[model samples]
Target: MPVGEWDAVLVGGGVMSATLAVLLAEVRPDWRIAVLERLDDAGQESSAGWNNAGTGHAGLCEFNYTPQRPDGTVDPAGAVRVAEQFAASLVFWGRLVERGVLGPPEAFVRSVPHVGLGQGTDGVAYLRARFEALRGHPLFADLEFSDDPGVLASWLPLVLAGRTDGEPVAATRAAQGTDVDYGVLTRRLLAALRERGGEVRLRTEVTSLRRRDGRWELAVRDRASGGRRRLRARWVFVGAGGGTLPLLQSARVPEVRRYGGFPISGRFLRTERPELVAAHRAKAYGSAAPGAPPISVPHLDLRVVDGRESLLFGPFAAFSPRFLTRGRRSDLARSVRLGNLPVLLASARDNRSLIAHLVRQVTAPPSTRMAALRRFVPTARDEDWTLVAAGQRVQVLKETGGRGTLVGFGTEVVTSAGGSLAGLLGASPGASTAVAAMLDVLAACFPAQADEWRPRLAGLVPPPTPEEVARARRVLGLAPVRPAVAP
Candidate 1:
């Protein structure tokens, strides 16, 4: 066995790990850092472009962020926070582009229309209220609302082409929204890290984690050489996606207690027809159907990758014990830890909503899915779109409300005192907001150094200030927009 030491060791090659690596390399260049990926390449899991919806996730089109209250009012705080995170991400990507770390903007990111659609009077009222609430925000300045048939047709003719007009409905459209190729961005960030003297080891898996003499020791297996090695680091980050839980458990960390992940497999429908694809130039999202879970919201999007124009719809959730589609089925059972048992029990008790979701998805047939798709595109042909398997998402579960609670959305950061070892858990707005999430990791663990690191972090992503927000609001024509639901 060979032994080596580094300043830090990151145990995942997805966006979260890659983003952390970039930030660490930028702030602490002298510190030796190494990345160990179990696969042959990076970003092949959740960060893969094809594995998840490509929306920038500013909360503009996702209704789940603005849940309605019994009093008819809605909360805008969650949406605003999500929007700010996305803004931070945009600034980070902008800096990465200027530094020549990423490819051309068109290769990984491009401006696309984002529309929120709804039907019937209740949906219309909700859409109208949501539009009013967000119109004044800088990030949401491009939003436009309409209930007129012609206006709806102009934004998405496919959905309105031949539908009955008597049904009360409306939509909000934002032209500034974008589609991102997270996989490409991850690769580019990895490249940048390497260029700045960081080490990225592919085909290497961290088989074990242990602490010795106040330092974290990682046992790594080199697939190509069939050799085992040990590496020591001042700090260890478990960003291993579905593999994150088991690895953290091996460290005997208290935070991994009672924490369990519910794996949700997703599938998308893709189209090859250029004319049908070109006609649909925007990303259209809608509220989940009755009795459907929030994550099951249907969306029709225009996906452009490597100079190709195509359409995609539905991240219809499926059941799988495997964390990643490409991962082993034993991942779930192996990750159960004694500490997390309480958390798991609590999660299951609290997530009655998600239990209903699991039942609905597990029993749904293909025809039912197609019928759901027809709601978004009345003219969609069953033959035009084929079901494509996407990445698996491990929804975080823990103790909440004296029982097992399952969290369908939101990201969790698990860190101990002084942040010696940290791991990110949960789902929703995953890659779209990696910059802000990693920044949180830094602030929590390295508070003193952040003052010095702040300037560099700013260079990578300009922190959202009141002035920037006000200016962006004005520029996006949000000055006239008013909040229908008061905060």
Candidate 2:
């Protein structure tokens, strides 16, 4: 029996679902909206502050976003697109703060410089090329670059400390970059949704989803009460992070027939030592090792969670058959279907280097992990940091040109059932791009409402102009932007 019907049902309590719920409420206030989460509380998974690096990924510090071309020039297109997307998120959040929908901006977001570090001769050259390529863009006009050790010392004292090697080094700094506590933001979005008459059901897991009579029927179970019920919705969105793949498979979505998932877990070295945290005031990203996945790019971040500061480093790969931290060990095996088996096998065959990289990371001892960290922080001590498990990211694998291809760090949104059903897959630059990604979902799934909703959506998340970006930064308590130094 169907207990309730809704205009939209979002299957997750993370940032993505919460964002979509809030957006829908703003656009179609008369439509009933509901969000279902399996966890006891919201934002406990990948959106959690501790589970991620907490960098507001605007393509500022992450070197992987800008790869070198054959001619030695850097590609700035990917980074520019990411910067624009993150600007939308900032604008939406700033509007919420201005309207009293969210509390103080400082509670969830803070200004933190983003720095891209490049070591060795080749690294230095690439860093300079990247800076030159991006400096002309409005979003990165304030970027600063330097190869002098003295200037670098002032910018990154902790990273420069105790470094005796004279190897060439370079860095680029963007002051507009920020560190965001997405978990706090997610919870706040959900809270605002409730205030707008949206329903949020926690501790309730959707067992399955089926299409019936122009609506999606979701079989839900109350984890605490052992009771089950059915609900109906005109549209259903699966934003369950790593758990999304299985749910889409269960729905028998044709778009997912040629898709598979490869689970990749990560561990970080975190420290709450006040001195160390204070010394490193920026999120610094370094290039990934040869033959490693882009997600393997090493980064050191200054994280502020719940008004407390700390430092995090080394997202060393960890192996787990489970798709999610709380998911079953059988998740990987259960997701392998006849339609996706070939894709999975091909992905594994083609990504042997990635598999080997994971193997090295999983079996590497403490000293090995420490050595990796020392590359970023020359004086880092093992005693000051402890290994902590990060979230599980399910990399999406799909058949492209008759061969399996592993999607990189970018997020992928899959829509099916004539745009009535949709799910989010992949990770990295995930939460930072929530607003833009959710907007795409709305456009893709609600084509009939596109023209009607265009005006309302525009008001909510307008195209980011230079003035709008400046205003959003000011509203978010960020400092004014500075002009870029001439190359």
Candidate 3:
């Protein structure tokens, strides 16, 4: 058996690992890095253009980030933080483009208006308040709101067409929002890594992980030949999406005991009709469904992949025992252990509404599903749109207060004691915030080098300083979002 050694072994070829590889290459070029993917190709799961909505999640349109306060005020802190992270990502991508590491921006990311929509008095009021709260923030400077039906028709003709106006509806638009092909971006990043002398192995799985002689050892199996090999790395990263938790557990990591994952599959209604696709060039995000979690928020988006335009809507949920889109059926039940059982059971008990929503979605009749699309596109035809499978997202369940609880909708970084190992958990705003997330991993996993790495990191990504943020907005051609003024 051949034994390979490296400075790092990144499990998974999705955006997270690819992004980390890019950053590491620029920061520590001499250190060898290898990315091992179980799938035959990179980004086959979560990061695929077809699998994700591809919104450049800068908090411009997502309502989940801003919550209403007691005084009826919308707190924009969460949104601001998310926006900041996205800004860093923009900076990273922009620099990569300039360096010829990535191809044309239009290939992977394109400017697409992002809008938040709501109807009824309660919903309208929330949208109105949210707009007011975010109006002058640096990150939301160019945000605009309109309650006029005539104006809405111009912005979202499909949504307003063939519908009579009764209850007032409102929307907020940010023309600087984007639709990104994370899969393409992932491939480009991997290309950049290879250009810099890094390695990526597809159709290769990391079968097991163990600590041996103060180093991490991974058992690798080639799907083609069924040949097994061993490899060692000074540091290891589990960015395998839903596959991360189980792999961490297999390594006997103590931190993995507190974490479990539940698979959530999404299906989208996609239309390639030129007319429909042309009518909507923006990503319109609506409020979460009744009794639904933030992750279940419905969105209607215009996606451009490989230069082809299309519209996608409705992330209808379904039940899948597999952790990944291609994982084994026994994945869900096999993940259970005494340490994580309480958390898993408690999460199941607490997330009854979520489970119920999934059940309703799976059992929904054709008419029922059509009605959903009608909410976003009043004149949507059953023939114009076809149901298509999106990606599988696994939400992380963590033990909190001795009970398992679903983590919030954003991403979380988990590092083992001594920082020898690290993994990313949770869903939503993931790929869009990969650079910022990887920065956190770098800081947590390599504290000794963080200070020295900070200056170099700034060159690779958007900085946190106000001046740098302003510069990033300019570099990325973003809507003016300077920072909100006190209302």
Q: Best candidate, TM-score-wise? A: 2
Per-prediction TM-score? 0.93, 0.98, 0.96
Query: Model 3: per-residue lDDT, tens digit, 1-487?
Result: 1349899899999999999998888889899899999998898899999988999998889999999899888999889989888878888887787787887667788789999998789888999999988886777876888888888999898888887758778888888788999999999899899999999999999988999998899999999899999999999999999898888889888987868888988899999999998889799999988888887788999998878999999888888988899998998998888988878888888879888988898899878878988888888889988999888888889877766578758788888858989999888778899998998999899999987887778788856565665565455555445332333
Per-residue lDDT over 1-487 for candidate 2, one digit per residue giving the tens place of the 0 to 100 score: 2449898999999999999999999989998899999999999999998888888989898888898999999999999999999999999998888878988889889999999999999999999999888989999988999998898999999999998998888999998889999999999999999999999999999989999999999999999898999999999999999989999998999999889998888899999998998889999999999989998899999989887888989799998989888989999999999999999999888889888999899899999989999999989998999999988899999988877888867888899988999999989779999999999999889989999998888777878898887888899899778887685
| Candidate models: Cα lDDT each | 0.80, 0.91, 0.86
Residue pairs in clash, model 2? none
Q: Is candidate 2 or candidate 3 better by lDDT?
A: 2
For model 1, give the 10-residue run with minimal summed lDDT. Answer: 478-487
Number of backbone-clashing residue pairs for each candidate, in the order shown? 12, 0, 9
Model 1 TM:
0.93
Residue-level error in angstroms, candidate 3, position 38: 1.5
TM-score for predicted model 2 compared with the true structure: 0.98
